[model samples]
Target: MKVLDLQCAHQHVFEGWFGSEDDFHQQLERGLVSCPLCGDLRVEKKLSAPRLNLRAAREESSATRPEGVTLSNHPAQAELVELQGRMLKAMREIMTSTEDVGERFAEQARAMHHGEIERRNIRGQTSAAVALELLEEGVEVMPLPMLPAVKDTLQ
Candidate 1:
């Protein structure tokens, strides 16, 4: 298996795995390679430093992290991890500050949209039907990943 660094026209960088170099070429020629973000097909390989299979060289750089955590002492990589943590922390703060109506998300959202309830930040569960309904009603809603909550209450 080979992991090749790739980039999209939007400057979003990502890595793709292939069985061989020819496999990557074949996939690209077939127009099957796509950017995971925005699903853009107009992706082109950027000129980058050549890859070395040595473990030390790979570990020397900080960009190999599939997740935010890393076991390397690379300062560049540490900065990336720190930035990721800050972003995640900011998102958690927002989620914790918002009201959680749970399954009543759609109901509460519509109520607020129609002036039946006070407008405020809220977070909760909603079905596809509810999401579509909210969109039809011009209610601004955004789907977010499940995030960790703030430990405001003592267990």
Candidate 2:
């Protein structure tokens, strides 16, 4: 397996694994290689140093890590991760407070707006057309992104 450092036209750096240099070229020619972050298809190889994994015979105190915590060397990435955590936390709070009305979100929202049902916080799945229609009818609704993994974990 050949692991090469790849960069997209957007300047997003990532790794690409290939069977050989020829295989990498073949994939690139076919537009199969892309930036994972931005989904850009214009990717090129970047200069990379060979990786050497050496097992230490002894432990080094300087290389020790604290329990239950992992540290990132990139400051920007660390900040982004922290921001993402905060956003997810806020989203989770919103999800907990809102009732899941599923596909009836549009109907429920319209009913509430027309005083046919008591107004309450709700979250659900609805087509873009339905959401637009709800908005047109002056029924307020906020779109909530549902993460499949989080859905199973939510109480």
Candidate 3:
């Protein structure tokens, strides 16, 4: 059975199961789809996951993962999950107390270094040139391995 994520004309989301893609198309074209929330017939596939063609010939060229084989999930996966949980918790605590100075990282750091501003925790973005300039001025700055892109959405 093939499972599909479907969205109605009214933006109501639902899932549909079918024997094949052709069966799904046939049912959809005949207005067989009914939105669970509003009971609307106008529905379309929202995000259909790529169907892996399981043709025997194609299988020869592709490296198939053994069904029983998995990662060292018994203990390592648990440890990794625990580590992630701890990191997230720590980050949440820090973000709540820490101040975000945005893009004026260099200027803010300079002010703090020169005692123009009170010394406190600050986070922001800066370019390589700005960072180098700060270093030349003997301003102590180290790059943090920030996970998320705080600047803006990628174009």
C-alpha lDDT of residue 75 in model 2: 53
Write candidate 2's Cα lDDT for 10-75 as tens digits.
665567789999999999999888765556889999775465454451133226854332332245
- Stretches of candidate 1 above 4 Å error? 1-71, 149-155
Local distance difference test values of all predictions, in order: 0.70, 0.70, 0.67
So what's the TM-score on candidate 1? 0.46
TM-score of each: 0.46, 0.52, 0.44
Q: How well is each residue in 42-140 modelled by candidate 3, as lDDT tens digits? A: 888765435556676346533454443232222543454456546545555656676889898888999999999999888778998899889999998
Root-mean-square deviation of candidate 1: 10.7
Off by over 4 Å in 3: 1-73, 148-155
lDDT of 3 at 10: 66
Question: Which order, best to worst by lDDT?
Answer: 2, 1, 3
lDDT of 1 by residue, 1-155 (tens): 96676666765455678889899899999987876543567777655455566888667654666554444323554564455456557676876699889999998999999999899999989887879879988999988766322322211
